[model samples]
Target: MLKWQWRQGIVTLFFVAVGLLLAILVGYSQPAFRSADSGSLSARSGVKIEYPVAEIKTGLPLPSDRTEVQMAAACLPPQRTPTALSFQAKLVTPEPSRAVPKYKPQQRQEKVHPTNYGNRMQRDVHHRRVNNELLVVLHETVGDAHGAISTFQTPHYDDDNQVSYHAVISRNGTVIYLVPANKRAYGAGNSEFIGINGVEAVQTNPSLASSVNNFAYHISLETPVDGLLDDHPEHSGYTQKQYQSLAWLIARTGVATSRITTHAAIDREGARQDPRSFSFPKLLSYLNQYPRPTEIPPCPLPPQG
Candidate 1:
């Protein structure tokens, strides 16, 4: 009986030892926990806190330190704007396009010159085949319209010394008809042309003198009073009236705005500097609004001798 009692006590001691070992092992395996506020132990105990993906990205409850927050923000991408949120929004609200301005055409009297005033012939007179009546050459008449008309009208005693243009615009914007619309007007002498259609080798080669008079329609603006009076005249700018009449004349020529150019631009001699201070932008703006003929009128038949 004594031996059996002793065996039961030994077995009880062994069981307690095994239980202590297991408790120690369980404590070691579990992570340690501490409460930030001892009063809210229940709130912290055995509860896991996890931040959401959105919170992680946005950094919700941002840091109080401005410098720290700025540093953190620097690492993040810029916030998208309403326009950036979707490309379609940008397309829906596109920037405005450039617009041309409006203008009224100026009316003027025609003091027509006689057929003798202008030389007879087509564009190809001196290999002057300026076909298509395409180019609108800008020139500044060194003298007034009256003088220009007289010069054109007078059958030059020496025809070789004669020069003429199609139309002349006075300082007051009066458009004077000098030469017939489609006739060669000797407007741009020693001029060269490289039209949009391709190189006119025969017309513009350096070796051969390029004269646009064949294909070009010349419009001369009367020099400003000061422009002509000043011996060493500079570009005395044109008046508003001049611009209006010039624009109208260009529209009449039945040519594209691209076809309009300056004598200085096409001149090979470089001595020609007419139509000073041309308002190209203003002219182009008005051209958009003005109506034009589909084609240049054919030259009137030379008056029967």
Candidate 2:
């Protein structure tokens, strides 16, 4: 009876030991519980652990002595913006246009000079051969409209010995008519076009031809009396009235803003300086709002001093 009792005890002990061994094997092969204090406590072949949530909620306390977050932030690039942590919300809106004065086309008191008006015979010849681009070179009338127009007209009497331009601006924002926009004017000196002669060359250049429709136009703005009195020394800084008129004139020219270039830009080596006091950013701002033209005119402006 004692021996039988002992055998029963031994069998019970063996079963208990086997159960514990099976439990340990299962735990070792499967993912286990995650603890709050020490990230996830998982048992797998090759396991990865995430950072403790508690550390994130309250930024980990900096070390007590000489505490610097440098070690923790070392892997990150320096932030340039102060508001980097702020939520971004974009607001797209249209900009308003600046005020502009009115422009009235002037009626020449003296029958516009014979040279100023296009010759009937000359017009017929150029009409068929005209291109679609106009190399617009802006100039500051060193003199008023009257003196400028007169100089271009009376070649023999003028001191510069020769002069010519397509149009002129009077002091009161009046646009004086001269040669037709379609006709070539003797503005730029010793200038050549990419595929044509002189000012017309700009029209012929492939790059310039493309910009003609978007960023270029032709107009001669009249500087204030000071510009003329001092031989247009101050013409670089033109008047608000003339600028207003020029903006309007360019709109009418059907040229693109991109194609509009200063005389100085085109003529690397020349004696023309016009549209003095030009503001590139201001002009670019104006052009950005305007549309490009479809037709490319063949006429171009000359380089100036």
Candidate 3:
């Protein structure tokens, strides 16, 4: 009878130990993982593994803490870089654009100052082609527009070749640029400009003469070969467009209307009479819009001599 009681007591102790261990594990939040079939706890690894009690009961192996940490990190979003963000913005944004102004023939390369075009830009500069502008001389090319422009394209010096006009107007009235406003044009030769009322000098320039080349802005008008010389000219005189362009150009300079004269009027030696078949009435009709003195102021006499 005593031998049987000892076996029974040892069996009770074994069951009691197992029951306590299960209670401890089930009550704790931090799961104590065990091998699929091995009921053993791992050493402290500082990583928690989540395994459902059902999974442990079934036979699925509990993943290691290191593997759990690596898998969790892989699921997080990637960090952004400045360069990548900028590229993305560029793809979504548009570039800025500008509108261009309309083209005008008068403004094409018409420099307000000299030195804008070099002497050799077309050809070398010759003789005096630089002087103070006082008169706006008018002329006729006696040639086609193309021929006149081509002529100025080649710079010259002597009276044989030294020639240029500040501007040229085609039969269609397109004002073509030739020289800067501040430069001299070979418009007048042996020509003289005596200001209205016998005022021959410009400011301190007492030596001023009819040779107005020193102070003139020469503007030429193209002539059709057939219309170069006509007796009592009619349709070939000048176009309305030409008159408009001329007046506009004259106004731009702000020069006095009376100061505006013709190549024929200023020509000296009586050998020149150009800008033929022209109508002063037509030119004045358009030029009248500019500011001009109503009357010429009298010239002061030299203290009654």
Q: Against the true structure, whose TM-score is highest?
A: 1
Number of colliding residue pairs in model 2: 36
lDDT of 1 by residue, 1-305 (tens): 99999999999999999999999999998643322223243322454322111112232333232233232322333221111111110112112234423443444434343533343333342454433325778888777777877777666545345578877888887777666654556667677665423333123323435566556667888887777744353766888888887776665444555567888888876776666767789887666565533222222232243
Tell me the TM-score of each prediction against the true structure.
0.53, 0.45, 0.50
How many Å off is the CA of 83 in candidate 2?
Answer: 52
Model 1 has a clash total of 7
In candidate 2 the C-alpha lDDT for residue 93 amounts to 20
User: For model 1, what is the error of residue 104's alpha carbon versus the real structure, in angstroms, after optimal superposition?
Assistant: 7.1
lDDT of each: 0.55, 0.45, 0.53
The candidate maximizing lDDT is 1
Candidate 1 overall lDDT versus native: 0.55
Q: What is the lDDT of residue 15 in candidate 3?
A: 100
Question: Which lDDT tens digits does candidate 2 get at residues 85-181?
Answer: 1211121122225433344344342223444222212112224222333445687676677777766666343312434566676667676656554
Q: Which run of 10 residues does model 3 get worst, by summed lDDT?
A: 80-89
Off by over 4 Å in 1: 1-130, 157-159, 199-210, 229-233, 291-305
Worst 10 contiguous positions by lDDT, candidate 2: 80-89
Model 2 CA deviation exceeding 4 Å by range: 1-132, 155-160, 192-218, 229-236, 284-291, 294-305
